[model samples]
Target chain A: LAKTTQPISMDSYEGQEVNITCSHNNIATNDYITWYQQFPSQGPRFIIQGYKTKVTNEVASLFIPADRKSSTLSLPRVSLSDTAVYYCLVQGSARQLTFGSGTQLTVLP
Target chain B: EPEVTQTPSHQVTQMGQEVILRCVPISNHLYFYWYRQILGQKVEFLVSFYNNEISEKSEIFDDQFSVERPDGSNFTLKIRSTKLEDSAMYFCASSERADTDTQYFGPGTRLTVL
Candidate 1:
């Protein structure tokens, strides 16, 4: 599995855009970048996923650079309810997901 | 949005006692997984089940831990002997497919072992 590194914490005010970047220096060719969000006392919720370039959905947008060494999760117009831990996972052929210390995003009012 | 559901939102058990945590995955999903998170810690994968059998498991899934799809709808995790370290939030998730499919997770079962 490819190890991922992301910010430990980030603060954003309501209505501001939030971009959380994750670096996977040793990412494999077959790996895909996926993101999940988790509030306290709840299971992690899938946000978005991408293999390369950019992918956008109703929830968020994923921006993968040409090198694929890193990816960014962009959330537009953040709200107080968006406060949670954001996890950036590099998914490989392995069935199990290896989670790292996620970035805690604090959306202030 | 069909989501996974887990029973017994909270469970309190004594040390050495057996506990069974149950889950009902999305109706059409094929892959199932179990993950746990200690308070204030990162989520850790325990095991993944597909086609009524286990596909992979982490070191944390020791002999004391077992998973079963007893029936078509219910997936269960059994802890033969609970320890204090077993106290955590157990989450059950399922994906429609293996590769690139998004996994939907349940609210989780908080197991407190004393």
Candidate 2:
């Protein structure tokens, strides 16, 4: 499993764009970067996933550069309801997904 | 938008007692998993089940812990002898496939052991 490092916390006002970057210097070829958002009392919810380049959905976008060592999760038009912990994980074909200390994103109103 | 569902949103039990956390994964999904997160700590994987057997499990899933898929829709996690440290939010997740498909997590069952 590749170890991922992310900022401990980030703050943004409502309607601002938030970009959270994760670094996995030892990412493997088969590893795909996945992001999950967890609320205070709920299970982590899948946000977006990408292997390389850029992938976008209705909620967010994932940008992976050519290096694959780092990836960014971009959230557009943030709102107070989006305040939660964001986890960036590099997962292979393995059965289990390891969760690291994620970045706590705080969206202020 | 089908989703996983867990029962007994919150459970409180005494140390050394037994507790069972139940979940109903999305229909048509084949893979099931159990994970827990201690308060103020990161989420930790416990085990993954596929084809009526455990495909993978972490050291945290020792003799005291067990998982069962007794029926078509119900997947369960049983703690034989709950300890104080066993108190945490237990989440059940299921994925369409193990290789690369995304896993969907349930709301989670909060277990408090006293």
Candidate number of the best lDDT: 2
Q: Per-residue alpha-carbon lDDT of model 1 for A1-109, expressed as tens digits?
A: 7899999999999999999999999999999999999999999999999999999999899999999999999999999999999999999888788889999999998
Q: lDDT by residue for model 2 over B69-97, one digit each (tens)?
A: 99999999999999999999999999999
After superposing candidate 2 on the true structure, give the runs of residues whose Cα lies further than 4 Å from its correct spot: none
**Residues A55-75, candidate 2, lDDT per residue (tens digit)?**
999999999999999999999
Runs of candidate 1 with Cα error greater than 4 angstroms are none
Query: Candidates' TM-scores?
Result: 0.98, 0.99
The two-chain DockQ for each candidate, comma-separated, is 0.81, 0.85
TM-score of chain A of each: 0.99, 0.98
DockQ score, prediction 2:
0.85
